[model samples]
Target: MSLVKRIRDISVATLNDKIENAEDPVRFIDKYLQTQKRKLTELEKLYQQTLTHAHSVKQQFMEAESNRIKRENQAEVAVKAGEEQLAKLILLEKMQSEEKSEQYRLLYEDGKQTILELEEQIQNLKDEVQELVDKRAFYEAKIESIRLQKQLNQVNRFIEKQNYYDQSRSIDQKFSELEMQTNALREVRSNDTKTGSSFGGKLQSEVDAQFQQLKKKLEKER
Candidate 1:
């Protein structure tokens, strides 16, 4: 399937190939894991079938060899019993059993080789699938980080493109103007505080002089 091809192309050996703009790397990896897992199951079933075949071949080879030995014994007994015709028949049967055993032996050996190859394939495929399963979280998290970094880069570009620095300057200018106004207000309050104290002293001195003049007039009348 295309998923197999896609996943296979992401080489861990070569650093050149990158995980591209896959919308979801997890889904991509999962598709591959699922497909390979199916293949692994099929391989195991075939492995079992080959094992059964190999067992059958071995059994056939053993049976033929056993028959050959039995015929040889019978042929010796026949020859000792002075039965030449039966001995000849038994010898012929032994020869045929010997040939059959040889053929079965070859078949059994070939079956075992086939089983070995299939076992290797199954194990290799199983290991590859498991590696993907184990590394799934790591790759997914890395891809997510890449996606966020890309967005952050885009945001920084937009800020530069839209002249956000000028906006920042305008905000700074407003704060500066606000600070100046505050300073002006503080100076005006300070001046008013000093002027109010002087005016209070002058008014109090005038009231005291008027009170002294009224008391002198009352003393002159007495």
Candidate 2:
């Protein structure tokens, strides 16, 4: 199939998709409503044509019925005139007229049924178009709600990030304060470590010299 045909086929297949998946469903509904109006116009035109055809068929049927009745009356008159052969001929003609009338009557009846069916179809189409309009409105509302939720989510994220930034700033300020306190305490304890390490360094030097002297004496003995 061609592209146009494919699009038309898809449009027909998912007639409701026009509303359900529409980005702007209200606009879509408006367009669909216009399309339906045009379709209704076309259906009306065809309906008028069908009605005209039915009317013509009915008129023809009436004429045939009238002819049949006239033939029967003529036949009756002929019979009363004491003309037996002519009466028989007139009766035969009357029978033919009746058959023709019956055929026309059947045609008229069939046309009437067809016209009724068309009217029903047109009504059904109109109802479906209304359903489309209602559904489009519903979906459009849903879309707006979803969009609002997404916007809310975005705003919430921004607020959360802002809160995180505020917390980080507070933590940084606390750490800086702790660092200042730690430096002050270390300055106060600096004299204590200097005195302790001075004594410790002298004791370690004496122990090392004594061990070396003992090692020398043992080597000399060996």
lDDT of 2 by residue, 1-222 (tens): 544456545665687665667777778888888888899889888999999998998888888788888888888898898988998887888888788889889998998988877787677667767777777678778879999999999999999999999999999999999999999899878977998899899999999999999999999999
In model 1, residue pairs whose N, Cα or C atoms come closer than 3 Å (at least 3 residues apart or on different chains), thus clashing, are none
CA lDDT for candidate 2: 0.83
Q: 84 in model 1: Cα distance from truth in Å? A: 1.7
Error of 1 at 109 (Å): 0.5
Give the Cα error of residue 200 in candidate 2, in Å.
Answer: 29
Model 1 lDDT tens row, 1-222: 344444544544331232234566677778868888999999999999999999999999999999999999999999999999999999999999999999999999999988987877776677677777766778878878999999999999998977887888989999999999999999999999999999999999999999999999999999
TM-score for each candidate, following the candidate numbering = 0.61, 0.61
Task: Count clashes in each candidate, considering only residues at least 3 apart in sequence or on different chains.
Answer: 0, 0
Q: Which regions of candidate 1 fall more than 4 Å away from where they truly are?
A: 1-24, 147-222
lDDT of each: 0.85, 0.83
The residue pairs in collision within model 2 are none
Cα misplacement distance, residue 73 of candidate 1 (Å) = 0.9
